[model samples]
Target: MEKKIADALSEIDGAGRVTVVLTMKAGSRRMLAEETNNDDTSAVLVSRGSGYQETVTVQELSPQYQGALVVCEGAGDPAVKLKLVEAVSALTGLGSNKISICKGK
Candidate 1:
């Protein structure tokens, strides 16, 4: 599952973007990644609230890759958070888990 998600994220083109919000027992965090097709490309992570109220925001979009968003809930765990990001990234192409975000370009 993790690999699937990573692959999806990695597959995004330079103009593509992906956003992910993770809800956890301890808190919530958000991550955003924009595909640059450059090895230096990176994603941004944001955090808000604590425990149930916690949330994460991520914005990854561009002309090439387009834009995508994903939301996940689970106990606070590093691995889980990573998985959520990967899952959301994979959704861009496979559309698995019915995860998608319909927002601006």
Candidate 2:
């Protein structure tokens, strides 16, 4: 996540040498679609060929981010800082209050 954020932020105009730190509220977990019948609860299975049963994967849930810190050479500028904060928030699903933007040496 940090790497992704850095790469993304580096793309912004004047956001040079971006660095990112992220805090995760919870680790990612998978959600599976299940089959419930009366007293039985089981994973929904799909048959391949000749009776090969495969568990169905609904979707992969990404980790929830609590906060983010971004340091960039251009962050001293208000516009650059705001852009960094917004980009980080958009990528991490966090609010602006949870993101910090700082100037890098």
Candidate 3:
């Protein structure tokens, strides 16, 4: 995702050599369910009637982005920085406050 954002930002007229770093609020977690097995394998394995088991990932869950740091040569200029901010915001669905632009080498 960061790579895609950086590629898009590089399309801006003054933007050059864009690098994007994303900060996430938390790592993705999975839901679990309880299951039991009465088969012979249970004799060797830990046999818990209501054993905890990992379930398929919840499709609705999405990673929450805390912020983004963008570095680009064009970010030194006010106009280019604003444009970069807008581009990042659009791609991340985050507000301007969550995006920071910095001058790059």
Q: For each candidate, what TM-score against the reference?
A: 0.22, 0.82, 0.67
TM-score of model 2 vs. true structure: 0.82
Candidate 1 differs from the real structure by a C-alpha RMSD in angstroms, to one decimal, of 20.3
Among the numbered candidates, top TM-score falls to 2
Per-residue lDDT for 51 in model 2? 80
In model 2, the runs with Cα more than 4 Å from the true position are 37-39
lDDT of 2 at 101: 92
lDDT against the true structure, per candidate, is 0.40, 0.91, 0.80
Comparing 1 with 2 on TM-score, the higher-scoring candidate is: 2
Q: Runs in model 3 with CA error above 4 Å?
A: 27-59
Per-residue alpha-carbon lDDT of candidate 2 for residues 83-103, written as tens digits (9 for 90 to 100):
898888888899999998988
Error of 1 at 65 (Å): 7.2
Residue 27 in model 3: shift from native, Å?
5.3
Deviation in angstroms for 53 in model 1? 55
**Ranking of predictions according to lDDT:** 2, 3, 1
